[model samples]
Target: MLFIKTFTRSICTGKYSFAAEKSLLAALRKKTGYTFANCKKALEMHDNDLNRAELWLKSQAQALGWSKATKLEGRHTAQGLIGVAVNQYSGVMVEVNCETDFVARNKEFQSMVEDATKCCLRYIESQQKPQENVAKFSLDTEQLKGLHSENDGKSLADKLALMIGTVGENATLKQGLGLKTCEGIHLVGYAHPAGHVENGLQLGKLGGLLAYRSLGEGNDHIEIAKGICQHIVGMRPTKIGNNDDKPAPNKDEETCLIHQEYLLDDSVTVKELLEQNQLEIVDFKRLECGEIVSSIGKQPLEFVETCQ
Candidate 1:
């Protein structure tokens, strides 16, 4: 009778005498990247079972992520990272935004951006055909969010929610782009303030893709291609300048890429450099994390539009 009374009291008071509280909490936290407090709650809710605690935490995390995202979408998200993935035939860029630069610099946040960019690139590679235009295709956020990963079969939105839960911030996949080149064109990309490279993805504040058609034997100038991409990222030109438009003295008004001075030398114009190398610009794209569209009035020859 005394033992039964003690058990009833312990259960009623929510004070189960679990011997592995610390170990269980630590294991669940490691597995799910959840807070210790939440892990403890899950452990308690599930009778001190680590696997059950992890499952509960993940399920709650998904729900919590959406709630946090919806609540925080109204908050300004001006800081984030730009990630790029590219190959010889195609390239892709994706921007993921967060409310704070502190979150933007987080390694996990950067990894999520990288994964999204890579997924977009894979989509481009799979969807692109020989007849496709030589310009850029704007990837819709919803479609991108719906793309299922081959590894785990989870949609991007699902993974993004997980990230949101982990980061505890209002994160958004603001923009995505996939660029394709024509038969004669070559594609190259560069990330400003060259960041740490991982698995061929570039993560940084600004990124640019430059497409050029070799006019002669100059299509494969390694240094020249990289230099041009770097220049595009730094200079922020909107259009390809006319051939007659020569470089003027500090012509800040000249936003055309060809007329802009070479970023590597600055002694000669980009036009001059291209001519010397027998290269002609096919198209180019630059991406920043949270640029205001209304601010860029001087538009490129063709702006990337939403995919139809």
Candidate 2:
């Protein structure tokens, strides 16, 4: 009778182990999105604790994605969207890059860029010092990468890596700039392809921010700000100038903001339009995707990835 009891106990233990193994595999698969073999190995490594296994898989995935992203370093990323986040007090613009326009249009890619822009904006706001302008805040690639997103606590670099993994191409958070307005100053932004929305903020392949002080008494300055923003979107200006200054010899007209013809009335220059509207352009920022190569001193070969 003792021997029969021992055999029955052994059988029950074996059945329970098999059932637990099966359940763990299913849970790991659901959570990690890993293959059955990978999931089973992770469960075995963590002694079949579902939570531990999931965590291990996430870490592994992140490491792998980072490795993949590193391999894509130095690749040209000309195609991407410009993301903008703004409020009454401040506004931010960010350029995120990918290998192709198709990926640029991906909703996931677009969402990440938008989130990154908001993250940059929040970081700038947090760093604001008394009597200092927040508009002075700007981040390069590495600085922008270090910022944490409000949507998830993960750093922007981590988000970019995950996106690189998902899209099977390199991605980058190339540049970011923020602008702030004081009591007398007003900030306005424009994004081309105006239909794109990210986190309820407008986004496009090109974005511009204009900060100006209203010299006029009425709120028509608001309309004037919008008009300047629209002109910026169309003109793609690189620098703002006053009408009194002589044009820089050999300067690209397309890059000079005040030199460009006003979109509202092509007959007038942007500088003339500003003066007539009683607006003075205090500061402005324009972002176009993939404009960083000039600063970095290396022009990468632009290539599109195609499946073999």
Candidate 3:
């Protein structure tokens, strides 16, 4: 009788343990989006506590995702979007790159770029110095990675890693430029035809940022600022003024803002139009997708084939 009782208890205990583990595995898989094997391993590693297991799995996944992302780092990211965000006091531009145009057109990719740009703009707005003239802010890739998204509060690098894992492509926040207005200045941004309009601002493959200090009254300068932005989009000028000493003769007409013929009326130069409106160009920035070459040299054909 004693032996039978002990055997029954042993059987029941084993069944209970198995049932609990099965339940934990299912729950972990659902929460972490991990495979069955991965969930089981995580559960075992963390003593079957659901919260701990989830955290462990997440950390492991991030580590693995980052590893994959590193491998993709050297891949050429020629297709992407330029995003611009503007508010009453500040503006920001960002370039986010991916491996293909198909991904570039994806709404998720577009939303990420838009959010990143807006976040950058908000950061600049928060750091505004009212007493300064033309406060400028810039973020390199690593700094951009640390910025938290306003939408979900996720660090940009974490969001980027998830995107890389989901899309199976190399994506990078290539550049960021921020501008804040001082006293009489205002900021304007433009996106080319390939751009999309949101909140009355344009975002696309090519972007322009212009800072103008108004000298006239009652929103007239606003129109002038926008007109200059349009001209920038059309002309794709490289510099604000003819500051280049030995300017390339052939490229100067198209590359210098003051020298390019006005888009609205080709009869007048941009310099003359600004003078007519009594507005002065404080500063400007232009960013085109994939304009910067990758520092990583192209992989040899043999290496590419081996990976394939």
Candidate 4:
């Protein structure tokens, strides 16, 4: 009778223990997106404390991410997404690259891009130059990664590395644009092929940020600015050339913004629409994911020339 009671208690305890471990494994996997094996390792390391296990897993992921980043550095990252954020007075644009379109569409990957853009937006807010009504600057890759993420206190580099580990891919911050505008300047941005919005930030294949001032009392300048941005994203103009620039014979007149036909109204050019609205573009930036950059050799500070 004594032996039977002891055996029954042991069996019940074993079943309870197994149940607890199964629950912990499932919970940890859901929380951290780590594999079952990793979660089990974390649970064992931390005695099944969920929060502590999560922390340990994330800390361990940093090393994994760094290793993957180094291993995949030379791989051609031909696909990625563009993240652009615009608040009332300032905005930011960023391009984050990965090896495959499959990885580019990953939620974790998109989250990293969102965090990066938000970090840059905060940096732009801090570096506001009230003297310049409109300013455009490129972001240094190292500096951006060193900055703390706005969502969490983790350094952007660590966050990025953790993501690299999680997704098992080489992700890179190819380029970033920090934009600030004065109160009166209408700063707007548009994204083509935009995905779902998260905390006001959107990811897309192509993005455009535009800052312009209304020379006259234009009531609909906001809409006009957005329309121009849409046009900029669609047209891919190289310069804000004057109306006097000649069209290049047969190839659609697209070398300059002022020369391109207004997307909103095909009857008139962008210059004509601007003239009608009494608007002058202060500065603008168009970012397409993975576009070739001939002038990319220059440092961020070297590309700091401000436009009015």
Best by TM-score: 4
Give one digit per residue, the lDDT tens place, for model 2 in 44-68: 9999889998888888878888889
- Model 2, position 113: C-alpha lDDT score: 84
Clashing pairs for model 3 are none
Tens-place lDDT digits, model 4, residues 236-300:
88888865778667548567888888888889989899998899988888988888865542475
List the lowest-lDDT window of 10 residues for candidate 4: 296-305
Please give the TM-score that candidate 1 achieves against the real structure. 0.79
Name the top lDDT candidate: 4
| Residue 272, model 1: Cα distance from true site in angstroms | 1.7
Q: TM-scores of the models, in the given order?
A: 0.79, 0.73, 0.70, 0.87
| Runs off by more than 4 Å, candidate 2 | 1-53, 129-134, 198-200, 217-220, 246-256, 292-308
lDDT of 1 by residue, 217-267 (tens): 733676698799999999889887775766656677668888887879979
Q: Whole-model lDDT for model 1 versus the true structure?
A: 0.77
lDDT of 4: 0.82
Q: Model 3, which residues run further than 4 Å from truth?
A: 1-67, 242-254, 293-308
Choose 1 or 3, whichever is better by TM-score. 1
Scored against the true structure, residue 122 in model 4 reaches a CA lDDT of 86
| Candidate 2, position 48, lDDT | 89
